[model samples]
Target chain A: MTQIYNFSAGPAVLPKEVLQQAAAEMLDWHGSGMSVMEMSHRGAEFMSILETALADLRELLAVPDNYKILFMQGGALAENAIIPMNLVGRKPQPATIDFVHTGSWTAKSINEAKKYANVRIAAAAPDGRFHAVPKRAGWNLHRDAAYLHVCTNETIDGVEYHFNPDAGDVPIVADMSSHILSRVIDVAKYGVIFAGAQKNIGPAGLTIVIVREDLLGHALPCCPSAFDWKIVAEHGSMYNTPPTYAIYIAGLVFQWLKRQGGVAAMEQRNIAKASLLYDYLDASAFYRNEIAKDSRSRMNVPFFLRDESLNEAFLVGAKAHGLLQLKGHKSVGGMRASLYNAMPIEGVQALVDYLKEFEQKYG
Target chain B: MTQIYNFSAGPAVLPKEVLQQAAAEMLDWHGSGMSVMEMSHRGAEFMSILETALADLRELLAVPDNYKILFMQGGALAENAIIPMNLVGRKPQPATIDFVHTGSWTAKSINEAKKYANVRIAAAAPDGRFHAVPKRAGWNLHRDAAYLHVCTNETIDGVEYHFNPDAGDVPIVADMSSHILSRVIDVAKYGVIFAGAQKNIGPAGLTIVIVREDLLGHALPCCPSAFDWKIVAEHGSMYNTPPTYAIYIAGLVFQWLKRQGGVAAMEQRNIAKASLLYDYLDASAFYRNEIAKDSRSRMNVPFFLRDESLNEAFLVGAKAHGLLQLKGHKSVGGMRASLYNAMPIEGVQALVDYLKEFEQKYG
Candidate 1:
């Protein structure tokens, strides 16, 4: 097998150990003579897998007792609409929601929320640069809004919130899609925190939503029952046929995370990896990362070559060097290297070496 | 490795060959040096896999040019609400939806649809006894309904529709969750056919929806953009990050189905398999099936022993004999053998032999 590191933004690289264990258990999971894929979601074997995954995730994130974790499908994009649909009914008909438009994701959250509520852009990073999060104090939140929403980490723009904003009495709903497990958090601060599993958790199909107990039964009449937090919580996320195999794999990833010393250890490694690449990009004239230093994402770092002509050659060479998916999102044309919990420091070192080699040849 | 037969209703048994190929390629799919799980959904590798899957499924069903096959998330339960959210906009506000309440799944669909539309129970099977599909002549369908909804196969009831009822000009939406690939049908007859990929297909999470082209762009304002069929179709089902790994497995299953001679050949096998078990049950004094003979599901056969006390012993001995998941739904206390596309005739024979042995010993 080739020694390779994948840098795709999402549906991205998973740990080799996880993949190996999954492969070993593909035909017959734990001598049960049935693959995880073949087990009924309601069966004893799968229920235990789901329970363990939920528990491990709670332990890793130090989630508060007030929160209920929901394993759902459809990713962060779906959450954009689901959040508003589930929350807006907290107020009267045509309720309002406050949003901090940090980047592409929150901007999207605002647009989707508008379909279900009266959206007030509480704060927005200046210009279309998407390089920084607006200061917490700068937000002009609605006094009695249904919820204040924010995208803590922007996968495309490389911006991330360093501080949790105080929304007073209103609950804050944060979309932590990209950098969810990269740092420690006070789960008590936000009313809800959601992350699509592709980046740091497990797979794309599973969307993890952590909500306070009070936030459960208030979904709007138009909210689909399967997506209604109350129904999902009551069924233990089995209101619908859940992404069972993905949940099983996520449980395995959670166990793997615990084995690697939980979220605290993961954060330290993420900081080290992010710094190594950012320091090199800042020091070099050949490449530049545009996001504000303090607001830059530790999970996804998008940088550009000083000269545009060498871009194709850079990616081609990177692939040959066993580096892959360096191309940035089409919406933001450049390159991005996502260093998730599954990504090791060794992978970062190799990426740095490749950057230097490519610069020496073309700088 | 122990050879086991899985009789689970869903997340059910897959073809042995498919599992073997999947296990062999789990670490590195098709020499790509990346597990299918690790591939980027937008990348060429996964795109090729997705394209082939759609092409193969279309070929297998002989799907028409006007119908688009959408690979979605959230399963059929979610689609119950999603359907009304998308179609009600085509008519006046609070559009009426006519439903046939035959069994558990249809009742669920009707309840979910009520949240989005004015639901009319066009027909009902009495006292929750799912012994038969209500005859079409007895249905009191709303003349101005937005759509007529039916569950082609009731997984819990062990009942199936053997005929398609006309809805005048109103489109028909069929929840074919448990029996989708077990038979061939005319695609043009229905406006939409939706199924969760836990049975006959491949894993859960991935949902298959075949909808006519005209049903595309009528989603109500309350409909989540991610669940909106028009927006989803336009984005190639990538409005949200899809269930990439599940889709890949489904593609594999579709390829496997093709090798076993498409839906037509599989239908013949299913008919024979259903006949074998049903004939034996009818001939025996110890066992009985309650579903109407004409409407009995070819995919799920639920039978009860005359001596209910023997149930535990029967299951315990069956498990020891390598037959698994024969316990019927808790709501219906009996045994069900789900003969999906993956169940070989040999496995059916084995179950039949066990039934005969048990009856002889207990009689």
Candidate 2:
């Protein structure tokens, strides 16, 4: 079989060792005589898995003691509405939610919030293109806004926030879906941080929400009991039947992250991997990545071919060389290579070599 | 290696073959060089898995063409809130919804729906105990009810509906989480059928919603877009990233069901399994099942030891014999042996033999 490297944006590549361990334990977990999938979520076996996962994730991110980690379903897309429902209740009726519309994800968040609150676009990309994060200085934040929502890493547009914006006394709700565990950050800086687990975490079904303790228990009357963060935190995320198998896989990934010396080590490797590919793309005239240097994402790198007609041939040759899912998102018709933490430097090098070869063949 | 039988209520046992196949494909699915967990939901490879699973499920259930199958997250508990949000919009503001509260599951649904609509208990067990389903003849369903909700099989109460309730022009929305696909039923009779995939289906985190076409677009303004049935059906459950891995396992289970001669054959096996266990409980003075004979669930059998002191010893002996997770739910403390579609008759026989042995040793 040919060597393969996957580059799908979310539900992307995972550590091979993690997959192997999951496969090995698929039938019976640690002599329990039941597969992890077969164990009841309330059982000791699955409880241990859930606790360990939560602990490892907290330690890796250095989450403050005041923050609660919640394991939820429906991903970030659902959280778009859940956030407003849970947070807007703390403010007055017809609460205004401040949003920094950096890219596609924030746009979705802003639109979903409109159903629950009066949404204010605090700042947006001046060019109407998602190539850069709008400057924080220009943001027209509302003093009485419920919360400031931002997509710290725009998965589709390949834009990222390198620094945390100061929101004064207001809380910051950041959607860190794509670049969550790929780097280390101060967990205390944000009022709430949420990510769909498919990208840098585990599977698509599981979502991780980290919110401060003070942010609990103000959900609107319409909030689903299961999605109410306070109720979920109080029950240790078992208020409803959680995604047990997905949580188990995520626990395994957390263990894998620890074995690799935790998130800091993974971040260094991610940076090196992203640098290798970005450097090659910058030096090549045949390929161009249009995003500003400082704003570009280390996790997802979307680029275009100088001659657009060679796009299909470039993808065909890339696949022949065992590079897979390199096509950009439909919203942006180009090529994208995601350098998530699980992606090794060798995969990046192979793709760089392929890029050089493809440009030479079609120049 | 003990020959173990898992009797977990939810996050329950799956077919051995399904687990083995999933293990084999954990690293790479069908030579795609990516685990199903690692594939994008929009990509062809994952799409194929989703489509095949949906098709297999439709075939096995004989779902009508007018009904749309939606793959969602948050389990049946979340669906408790989601159901009212999607249905109550059909009627005017302060819509009245009717419910047949036979057991714990329906009680929970009634409480959740009260958040969105005015809930009326159309019929309930005359006695407070959940021993039997309320007969349809006694139902005082509202003529203008948005829908009448029923729990076909209450996992905790072990009460099963042996006959479909007639609601006239009012639609019947059944929560078939624990007994779906174990028997044949006419799909056209109900407006919506929802089940959490942890009982008769696959793992938790994936919920299946089968709704008639006319029930699709009545979502309330506050309904989360990801859980909106109309939006989900339009995008084929890809409006938000689905629980992809769970769906894949469910598909495998569907295939396993097909190989076992579909739901009709499973119904025969289930009848035999339930009969063997129920007969033993009835004949033995040491054991008793409280559920009415006509309403006893074929999937979940909750029984009690006449001498409650021997409960610990019975469980210990059962575990020693590899009959695992036989403890009853906390709400009803005794024992529950869930004989889902994946459980073979041999496992039931083993449990029966153990019950006899335990009774003889301590009677």
Candidate 3:
């Protein structure tokens, strides 16, 4: 069988070891005679799993003690509404939320925020092309905005923020859905950091939200009790039955991360993997990566075929070579290779070889 | 090894065949060279899984073509808020919602509804004890109520509604979290039926919401786009990333259910399994089931030992015999044997044997 590498933007590749461990323990987790799916969320076994996951995640991100880690559902898209429902209540009626509209995800967040608060675009990608992140110096941030929202990495646009923006006194809320654990981050710099676990963490259903303790308890009157961060934090994310099996899988991923020397080690590998592909794309005229070099995402690399007519053939040949899901998001209409933490250097090299072969065939 | 029977209320037992199939496909699903977890929610592989699961669910429930099945998250608890958010917009401001206060689950739903609409208790379990479902004939229902809410099966209280309430022109919404798919039902009767997939469907993170087509597009401005039935149905639950792997496992369960002669056959088995334990409890002086016989849940049977002092010893002995997760919910201090569709009749007989032995030694 050919070695396969998956490059889905989210719900992407996971550590091979993690998948193997989960398969081995699928029926009887450590001889408990029950799959993790069968265990009660409140049971001692699952509680340990949850606690260990939380502890390891906190350690991996170097999260500050003041930040409360919440294991939530509905992914980051749901959090778009949930965040405002929890935060905007802290301000007066019709609170204004400042947003840096980097790309699709941030735009979705902004649109969702409009349902809850007055949204202000503090900055947007220049010329409306989502090829680069706008510099923070040009942002017209509001002094009294409830929070400043940014998508640190845009999966569709292949843009990322390399520097943390100084948001003055307003809290900086980041949608790090696509690039969270691929690198080490300063957790204290942002007031709230949320990511869908499917990308760099674990699976699709579980979402990780790290919010500063002071942000607790100001939920809008209509915020669902289950989604109210204060309520979630008070009950330790068990206010409602959590995504238990997803959390178990995430715990295994965290353990795997530690074994691979944590986020710092994973970051170096990701950097190398991303660079290998980006360098190849930059050198070849047959393929063109549109994003500004400075803003290109290390996790998601979106590029286009120079000829445009070879898109289908390119995908066909790529799949034949065991490079799967290389198709870019439909919204983008190109090709995207997501080198998430679990995507190996060998996979990147294999993709590079395919890129070269495709170019040679039709250059 | 002793055979194990898990009786957890929500994150409960699943079909052993489903678990085994999921393990077999953990690395690569159907030659796709990607685990279900690694596939994009929008990919062809996951789309097939989602469509097949939906079709099977519709067939099992005999769902009408006018109903839209949505794969959602945040469980039924979150739907307590999402329901009101989506439905109340159909009525005038401060619209009233009627609820039959049956048990703990309905109480939570009523509380969450208070955040969005005027909640009126149309009926309550007579005597304020959750021992029986309130007779629908006595309900003080409102003519203009937005929707009538009921918990079809109360996991913690062990109360189940045997007959569907006739709401006249008012649409009925049910939380069938713990007992969905355990029996055949008329799908056209309810305006919405939502269940967290942990109990009888699949895993914890995936939520199944079957809503009438007309129920879409009336979402309040405050409803999250991801939770809006209209947006979700339009996108086939791809508006946000569905819990892909959980949905795949659910697809496997649906296939397994079909092989077991569909829900009708499972319903008969469930009836037999519940009768085995309930009949033993009624005949034995050492045991008692608090729920009214008519209101007793065939899926979750909560019972108390005659002597309260022996509670800890009873649980210990049950665990020793591989009767796992029999401890009842904290709100109800007793033991619960949940005979979900996945639980075999043999597992119920094992519990009954344990009950007889325990009574002989401690009666």
Name the candidate that leads on lDDT.
2
> Deviation in angstroms for A65 in model 1?
1.5
* TM-score between model 2 and native: 0.99
Worst-scoring 10-residue span by lDDT in model 1 chain A: A124-133
lDDT of 1: 0.90
Q: Residue B274 lDDT in model 3?
A: 91
Give residue A164's error in model 3 in angstroms: 1.7
- Residue B136 in model 2: lDDT: 79
Q: What C-alpha lDDT, on a 0 to 100 scale, does residue B32 get in candidate 2?
A: 89
| Residue clash pairs of candidate 1 | none
Candidate 1 residue-wise lDDT, B277-355, digit = tens: 9999999999999999989999989999999999999999999989999999998988999999999998899999999
Write out the backbone clash pairs for model 2: none
Among these predictions, the greatest DockQ belongs to: 2
Q: What are the RMSDs of all candidates, in order?
A: 1.2, 0.7, 1.0
Better of 2 and 3 by TM-score: 2
TM-score of B-chain for each predicted structure, in order: 0.98, 0.99, 0.99
Candidate 1 lDDT tens digits, A1-53: 56888888888888888988988888888889999999988989999999999
- Residue-level lDDT tens digits of model 3 in B206-227: 9899999988899898889999
Instruction: Give each model a TM-score.
Output: 0.98, 0.99, 0.99
lDDT tens per residue, model 2, B205-259:
9999999999988999999999899999999999999999999999999999999
> By DockQ, is 1 or 3 better?
3
